[model samples]
Target chain A: DAGVTQSPTHLIKTRGQQVTLRCSPKSGHDTVSWYQQALGQGPQFIFQYYEEEERQRGNFPDRFSGHQFPNYSSELNVNALLLGDSALYLCASSFRQGAVSSYNSPLHFGNGTRLTVT
Target chain B: QQQVKQSPQSLIVQKGGISIINCAYENTAFDYFPWYQQFPGKGPALLIAIRPDVSEKKEGRFTISFNKSAKQFSLHIMDSQPGDSATYFCAAPYFNKFYFGSGTKLNVKP
Candidate 1:
């Protein structure tokens, strides 16, 4: 069983540039969530996508958005990025079983993409 | 604001000693609490978890002690080994969302 996979292990961009990060959830999982982890900090929830729609979002600004494809893959887009946006972007996947919610499924994470905005 | 708080930003323990990390949350709606361990340049992995109804849950050397009344939970690693050294995070789930603590960096010396 292949685990969650993220592309572009490392990236570098200038301020005001846009960046797109991709993620492919683990096989047999349908829900995808994105998080940002700053240096020496815990991962912060960015948003979650289920059934091709954003189900829940964190306190992040509108600059951060995401999409869930029908295949269960996901893409996180950050427009006009700021230097502070530099951080490790992690993608987590879990199965949404029944009506109980995806929280019931333990999350499996990808290695994450390290974004450096200069 | 950080809904979940973790203590002792970092800790060091001798091999074969016990290592403990604590976390507290203010949200009462949280029912599931999980601990994650992460290594450098890698994502966090689920270590163990506990529900509010359960006082404790153990998996091998990792144990999760949950105190529902105090809204606090802790992770205890018994017979710590150098390979166990890493950053640990405590988290709770609210609705379909999850919140994480700042994390604790543990160093086990051989």
Candidate 2:
């Protein structure tokens, strides 16, 4: 079973530019959630996608958007980025139903895309 | 607002000692609590977890002690090893969304 995978292990973008990060959820998983981890900080929830639709979102602004493809893959897009947007973007996949009770089940994380917005 | 708060920005311990990190949550509705461990240049991985209904859950050297009334929980590593060093985060899932603590950096010296 392949774990979550992210593309563009490292990314560089200029201010006012747009960047897109990709993720492939674990096999047999339906829910994909995105998080942003800044330097010396914990991962912050960005948003979640379920059934090819966005299910919930965090405190991020409109500039941060995401899409869940029919195949359960996801893309996180940031428009008009700022320097503060520089962080490690992570993609986590989990089974939406009966997830918490499964002892062997936990959020499968990707290596992440280290986004550097200058 | 940050719903979950963790303590000890960083910790250093000798090998064979125990390392403990604590976290508290403000939301009572949170049912599932999980701990994630992250290393340099890597994403956070699930280390251990517990539910509010349960007071304690153990997995090998890792244990999660949860206090429902206090809304507090902690991760304990026994006989800590240098490989155990990493930043740990405590999180809770609420309303289909997940919230995480600030994080604690743990370093074990051999």
Candidate 3:
């Protein structure tokens, strides 16, 4: 089965410009999460979407937001981007049953979209 | 603040040698610990995981040793190979969220 897929493998934008990144979760998965990975650093959780609604969010600023569709695809929007916003945006998917409070399954991740803010 | 702390930012090992990476967390509520491996131009992939109830879990050459009391966990790779060279990250999943360590770059020399 095809795994999680992210579009626009690489992107470049200027400061204060807005950027949108897209993600399609793996087939048979309903939960999608977004993360930011800086150079030589680990991935930081941005937020998570389940059942087309945002369920949990990280400590990131309000400039970062996301949406999940009925089809399980997701879009991450960054407004008033700063130079520090430059990083690799990764999309991950997992299968959750019922209204579980915790995730026991491992996440399947996509290659990610590399964003560069000039 | 980084929820999960990892040590030895990078490592170099000869082929067929053992490689180990360690991580520690302050939160005691975290129960699920997983390790992910990432290659250049790719995202991290699940390597192995362990729960607090288990002291150690082994999967092939990869093993995860978890210390619930110490809030520490480690990943051990046996007989390392060049193909295993990649960046490894330790993650703790708590309350439906994940906290990842800085990452460990492993370079296995042939």
Candidate 4:
């Protein structure tokens, strides 16, 4: 089966511009999460989407938001981007057996979208 | 505060040698721990994981050792090879969220 897929493998935008990145979870997964990975650093959790609503979010500001559609695809939107927003945007998918039980499902990741803010 | 902390920012090992990476967590509520491997321009892939109930788990050349009392864990790679070179991250899940370490860059030379 195809793994998690993300579109626009790479993107470039200037400061104050809005950018939207897309992701399609693995075939059997129902939950999608987004993370930001900077050069030589581990990924930081951005937020997670389930049941078409945002279930949990990390330390990101209001400028960063996401949406999950009925088909389980997800989109991450960053408004008024800044130079520090340049990083690899990763999308991870997992099967949700239950709200808490699903934590056992190992996360499958996409190749990720490289976003560069100029 | 960073929930999970990993040490040895980078490491170099010869082929057929053993490479070990360590991590510690402050959240006692975290019960599941996982390690991920990533290469340049690629996403981090799950390598191995362990739960607090189990002190150790092994898969192929990778092994995870957990010390519940110390709140520390480690990944050991045996018979390392050049292709094993990659960045490694240790993570823990809490309240449906995951906390990742800064990552360890391992270079196995042949």
Candidate 5:
């Protein structure tokens, strides 16, 4: 089966600009989450979307937002980009509701978009 | 605050040796611990994972040693090869969100 897919494998933006990255969840998955992995650091949760609604969010600012399409695809948009925003943005997907019950159920990941904000 | 903390930002091991990566989590609420492996131009893939109920779990040449009381876990790769060189990440999930460790980059030299 095809795994999660992300758009624009790489992107470059200037300070104070805005950018958007896209993600398509894995087949059979209904939940999508976005994470930002800065250089030398692990990915930090940005937000999660399920059933076309924002279900959960992390410590990110309002500048970071996301959307889930009817097909379970997702988009992550960031405004007023800063140098610190330059990082690898990853998308992960999982089945909803009961999927979380299985402790060993791992979230399938996309190759990720390497966002570089200058 | 990051719930999961991984040790050794980078590691170098001889080919045919064993490689170990460690991680410690503070949240007892975390029930799932997973290890992810990433290549230079690839996304992190699930290499192995373990649950709090299990002390150890092995699959093929990969193994996960979990210490629930210490809230710590580790990944061990037996017969490490140059192909095993990559970044390893430890992660925990709670409150519908996933938190990842700093990541460990392993280099297995022949």
Candidate 6:
């Protein structure tokens, strides 16, 4: 089965601009999460989306936001992007079992979109 | 505070050697610990995972060892090879979100 897929493998934008990245989750997964990986660093959680609503978020600023659709696809929007926003934006999908409060599902990730802010 | 802390920012090992990466977590509530491997230009992929209740879990050459009292876990690669060279990340999931370590870059020389 096709795994999680992300759009625009690479992107370049200027500072103070906006960017939207897209993600299509794995076939059997219903939860979508976004992460940011800087060069030589591990992924940092941005937020997670389930049931079309943002369930949890990380320490990122308000400039970062996401949405999950009925089809389980997701979109990450960044406004007033800063140079620090330049990083690899990864999209991960996981199957949700049991209660929503306990989410220990392993994530399957996409290749990610490399964003560069000039 | 970093929820998950990984050790040895980078490592180099000879062929047929053993590679070990360690990680510690600050959250006692975290039960599920997972390790992910990532190649250049690719996203991290789940390699193996273990829960607090289990002291160890092994899959082929990969093994995860958990120390509940110390709040630490480690990934051990037996008989490492060049193909195993990649960035490794340890993560702890809490309330639908995962916190990842800084990552360890392992280079297995042949």
TM-scores of all models? 0.98, 0.95, 0.97, 0.98, 0.96, 0.97
Q: Sorted by TM-score, highest first, which candidate order results?
A: 4, 1, 3, 6, 5, 2
Error of 5 at A28 (Å): 1.0
For all candidates, state DockQ relative to the true structure: 0.72, 0.59, 0.74, 0.74, 0.73, 0.71
Once fitted onto the true fold, the runs of candidate 6 whose alpha carbons sit more than 4 angstroms away are: A97-104
User: How many angstroms is residue B56 displaced in model 2 relative to the true structure, after the best TM-score fit?
Assistant: 1.0
Per-residue lDDT tens digits for candidate 1, residues B1-110, read 78999998999999999999999999998868999999998999999989888999999999999998898999999999999999999998786688999999999999
Error of 2 at B13 (Å): 0.5
Two-way lDDT contest, 2 vs 3, winner: 3
Candidate 2 residue-wise lDDT, B2-92, digit = tens: 8999998899999999999999899998768999999998888988888788999999999999988888999999999999999999898
lDDT of 5 by residue, A1-118 (tens): 9899999999999999999999999898888999998887888899989889998899999999989999999999999999999999999998866455535446888999999988
lDDT of 2 by residue, A1-118 (tens): 7889999999999999999999999999888999998999888889989888887899999999999998999999999999999999999998876454333456789989999988
Q: Which whole-number lDDT from 0 to 100 does residue A1 have in model 4?
A: 97
- In the range B27-60, model 3's lDDT, one tens digit per residue, is 8888589999999999999999888889999999
Q: Please tell me the TM-score of chain B in candidate 1 relative to the true structure's chain B.
A: 0.98
Candidate 3 lDDT over A6-116, as tens digits, reads 999999999999999999999988899999999999999999999989889999999999999999999999999999999999999998755454446679999999999
Full ranking by DockQ:
4, 3, 5, 1, 6, 2
Question: Which 10 residues in a row give candidate 5 chain A its minimum summed lDDT?
Answer: A97-106
Q: Which tens-of-lDDT digit does each residue in B1-110 have in candidate 5?
A: 66898988999999999999999999999868889999987888888888789999999999999998888999999999999999999998886688899999999999
lDDT for B30 in candidate 3 is 84
State the C-alpha RMSD over the true interface residues for candidate 1, after superposing those residues: 1.5
Better of 5 and 6 by TM-score: 6
Interface RMSD of 6: 2.0
Which docking band does candidate 3 fall into? medium
User: In angstroms, how far off is A20's CA in candidate 1?
Assistant: 0.4
